[model samples]
Target: MTAVDFEGFVERLATVAGEAVMPFFRTMIGVEDKGGLGKFDPVTAADRAGESAMRQLIKSTFPGHGIVGEEFGSENESAEYVWVLDPIDGTRGFITGLPTWGTLIGLLKGGVPVYGTMSQPFTKERFFGDGGSARCRGPHGERKLRTRACARLEDATLSSTSPRLFSGGDLVAFEALEDRTRHTRFGGDCYAYCMLAAGQIDLVVEVGLKPYDIVALIPVIEGAGGVITDWEGGPAAAGGRVIAAGDRRIHAAAMDLLRSAGA
Candidate 1:
């Protein structure tokens, strides 16, 4: 009936996904190359299992709601309240035995992201937010999350999944961001956005993402007083090239650099 209720279900969904994925961690799991000959986009049994487990839970709890997932495709996509899932937001990291990967669970009401969560079960960490507030939970404890006040790009710490993930025009634009920021690091995926929400990283610029890749991150970032947008300064709900910043000034500056890169 309310978003709070939906948020609870999101938590359950994340838990289910975590359970399904943890079994495959560091187990020399089998990986299928989703990418082409020259690329390494990998998906494993854990990815498929995690998504399937979550889907079953969602269907049982909210049968009328639509579902959009990474592995299984979309179902009832026209329904008003849809659950967007990325069982393993960082499949590359998951396959590599890195704990940076997470299960992304998001709720979209009428096609706009209203709530989202990123769960790293291996680390026992989950970051979640509605449109207004964000929080993080882990083996240590739970605490409210808010983006740090960083007014300029030069003073910002930035991250991306990897420089290798970008190419052509997107690469040019991302390099422009890297050149402007204080420092840039690679390898984050969904964790980069959560780090921004925790006010650890100031900006996250990524390319070639699908809706499931970012829908869950949008609410958490926005709730923590950060901004998520495409390179053109548009809403990133549909996902593509994404730029998330902890401060408006920083977002503007990054967007400007992206525009110049396009020029």
Candidate 2:
């Protein structure tokens, strides 16, 4: 299979994401349940419309490519190259007027993420990674990005999507993490990984994610010089658990915590 143009694709996708999300930033709109884990967390018109826009852009610009989106199902799945889009990764945060939500776009070559971009329109911040390099773009032009050097879990800061979702082994692992980390915070979706990439947060442990949620994040986090994998150190493919850290030392420690708790 032939590889896609990572740089060009990121620019185009960023433009589409920015354009599609800005209008609905803080506007008054009704929210409805798409029924995943519950009713409080769901998609909105903005999510559907944004994914549609990205899919259209890909179809028109790269008709031979495939797509896997959160709102819509897969298309042209047999193509050599595929795009995974989560138009709005943080639906609850967006609906609640929190600026932590973001638009995620990822390109997988033969089912492996090779390039990706995450955009936060309200904050005017963008992070991108592909082919081993990652950078962030803001009002000051582009800046090189990297994870921090926090050497241990005890020394690191931690964040999770929510504590309520963890059950059985997941809940036990999370509790251990809380006891180990220097600090812990909550309420960030895919943006938590972005913060880790920027070195703002050191560790992000989460579960109940699809490929579209974590694939776009892999290159972004690792390219920024971090480590991301499932709790068992497997790749965070769709529908798998994820434990992303800004440094390898912390990653190993976090994994130890999960395994210790029988996760």
Candidate 3:
């Protein structure tokens, strides 16, 4: 089936996921530490619940499709068509009662990202794309998504989930890029990427990411006429240290600084 055909189903998945997660927001929900000592990778019951709901829906609707999720492990991952999910992309923000978290749903065909959606139920907003085009629907009203042009780093606003995610040469590269930007903000997670797609942000640099963390964002950025790639200027579908720029000129400039730091 064509990617466009899955759009309706994707929204349904987002609805169910949001329903599963909203109950835990701003509540005293239990949390589990997925990371060991010296690290704080947090996961909540909300994360599992949301992913479980989506998984169940996918299994019932398209039994042959694969699923790769953050809370639940992969199933039939080598199938021709696969779904990548990060039910609560910003679990840290969720637990902290921040609305920056969202549910990310992505579809892959033949191992390539074809469609994606980022839904923030709290804000009643949804952003979606199909690599070629993108749009957003929210309380503010629906509009086509587009990245703003800012060709120079000095005129750009940058964002990252956190500086803690970087180290060694990666840290050096990110800092250099941050210094060149007009401003840098932290703690966006997937929301930062969405903002970049909406023409509100210019650059997003992140490291130590998994496929589930970035797969859904590829279409959103590309659809909005932005560039997303590894520090070496390669495909970002597989994750790892990645950089996204609203303007290709800024993208090329960021890559140069990253390369200089051996990132």
Candidate 4:
């Protein structure tokens, strides 16, 4: 029922997420497929361990806060505060030794994202954002972040989890999307939104996602002067479809393709 002191919580959770995921990033680990439509979707010990670390921190630091994590189910739902977490956002990429994966942490007040941080241990990229400002932390220290001014889709670069992650009717819109953007690349999880927030990518589109998957990215994108919503221009929380673009024009263009696919 009350707003969280995001500045304090974001820093605490970012540290926990970064620490929990670091050891796993350095060591080799086995992977397993948690049932998706196909057999290739992967899950690793890091996913479970990292999320468990975050859950423990939330419970200890804010006992009244609710938590919704990818590896674990919801906890303390009656609480007014919600922490949405994806301990490892790109598990498929993570298992493959790809450094695009990152940890996502979002603090939501009554279902609205108000604070978030996406931290990539392998790449040493950290992004944290709240109502007032957003920034990235690296070897050079923190710097204010901003989305690009790319107003047209043709002038924009596109990125996503993977084009192959889409199937059937979903493939139609994805193909059309590539045709519109100046360039397209695969492999970015919550990090894609971080890139958008940092003005690195123009647009990020994903066909299927859960609330945990997109919630954390909302504040980071919006705080950095970008727009993120479902393809229909509705709330991203209500729908699995997510379109994050540096500018409104690029978002609209990507949405056009998504709409055409009936997404």
Candidate 5:
């Protein structure tokens, strides 16, 4: 696909996802638990339906592209282009009527994200990056995005989906970064990364994320002058342990803490 074609499609896909998610926003929707035995992870009709909508569009518009989604399994995962999806990224916020929840749409070229967007359907905001640049569109109008400059961890603001999402030594590792930061907040999921890319937050440290959860965020964060990588300074494509910083220096500082925590 040409560059323009793919970029335009990213926006189109976000719109499609937003349309799907709006139907179940605050209504009485059924939710099922998808966590380990008795753990209360949630999957709502919005999540399933949002993904189904995006998948149908992908299948019809780009029949050759692959799909890796949270609610559904992968399809043609080896294709040159794969659309990774997390229909409702922060299901907790979604079910609770919080606006931080968003639909994540990531386009991978040869297994690496070349484009991504986080669409908060309820708030009508879509933040996206097309490998080289990032921007946001919604009620506030469209504007270019750029990561803020923070050279030290001590001067940075930190965020994570939740402290509860991490456990054991991983929790300890995250706390090291947290304790060193200027301020700490929790629970934004994909939305937090969008904020970081838009020069709002500084660093985001998250662990145990799946490919669908993070793949779409990489391009958005990076294209906005930010850096996203695994704690050990590797490609974050596979998405197990992830750290994103608006500034490279802060990333390095946070990585030192994360790496030492694991040691």
Candidate 6:
């Protein structure tokens, strides 16, 4: 099936995943430490439940398609068409009862991202895109997504999940970039990227993200006429030390600073 043919399926995946997760939101769901000792990576029952529901539906509806999920490992991952899922892209925010978290559903064809959706069920919002175009539907009503122009670093508003996620050379690089931006706000996980796509934010710099963490965001950003790439200006699908900007000029400027800091 073509990418367009899968759009309906993608929405269904988001719906069921949301159903599985919403019940746990703001409830006393148990949180487990997936990160050992020095770190605090957390996983909750909701994360597992949402992923499981999506996985089951995908397996049943499109038996040949592959799936790579955060809560569960890959299955038939080398197939021609694959689904990448981060059931709750912001587990930290979810645990804190924050609505900033969302479910990320991305589709890859021949190993390249073709379509993606970020669904915030709590707020009844969905942002989706193919590489060429993007749109959002929410309480504000449905509208096309477009990144705002801010060609210079000094005029850009930047965001990251947390500065704490960066350390050593990465931290240094991020801080240098932060200093140049008009404003830097922390704590938005997947929501930050969607906001960037919606023209509300200008730049987003993040490090140490997995495929599931970023794959769903690629189409949304690119479709909105923004640019997303790695520290050295390579494709960001692999997701290490990534930077995205509403304007290419800002993207280039950010890359220069990151490279200078030896990121």
Q: Estimate the TM-score of every prediction.
A: 0.97, 0.94, 0.98, 0.92, 0.97, 0.98
- Worst 10-residue lDDT window for candidate 3 reads 254-263
- Which pairs clash in model 1? none
Give candidate 1 regions above 4 Å deviation: none
Better of 2 and 6 by lDDT: 6
Q: Which residue pairs in candidate 3 have backbone atoms (N, alpha carbon, C) closer than 3 angstroms, thus clashing?
A: none
Clash count of each predicted structure? 0, 1, 0, 0, 0, 0
lDDT of 4 by residue, 182-246 (tens): 99878878777888899999998887798788887787888899998987898886437678888
> Candidate 5 residues 1-263, lDDT tens each?
75578877777788888888898898888888889776689999889889998999999999999999999899999999999999999999988888998888888888778888898877888888876899999997999999999998889999998888788888888887788889998998889999999999999998888998898889888889999999889999899889999999999989988889866
Query: For residues 91-190, what per-residue lDDT tens digits would candidate 1 score against the true structure?
Result: 8888778888999998888899999999999999999898799999999999999999988888999999889888887788888778878999889889
- What lDDT is obtained when candidate 5 is compared to the true structure? 0.89
- Per-residue C-alpha lDDT of model 3 across residues 69-165, encoded as one tens digit per residue: 9998899999999999999999999999999999999999999999999999999999999999999999989999999999899999999999988
**Would you give me the overall lDDT of model 1?**
0.90
TM-score of 1: 0.97
Q: What is each predicted model's overall lDDT from 0 to 1?
A: 0.90, 0.85, 0.94, 0.82, 0.89, 0.93
Worst 10 residues of 4 by lDDT: 1-10
Model 5 residue 8 CA deviation in Å: 2.4
Weakest ten-residue segment in model 2 by summed lDDT: 1-10
| Segments in model 5 whose C-alpha atoms lie over 4 Å from true places | none
Which lDDT tens digits does candidate 2 get at residues 1-263?
Answer: 32254577667787887788779878997788867665366878899888988888889888999999999989997788889999999888999899988999988888888888899888888888873878899887998888889987888999988898688988988898889899999998888888899889999988788888888888889899998999989887664678999889889988988899754
Candidate 4 displacement at residue 21 in angstroms: 2.2
Worst 10 residues of 5 by lDDT: 1-10
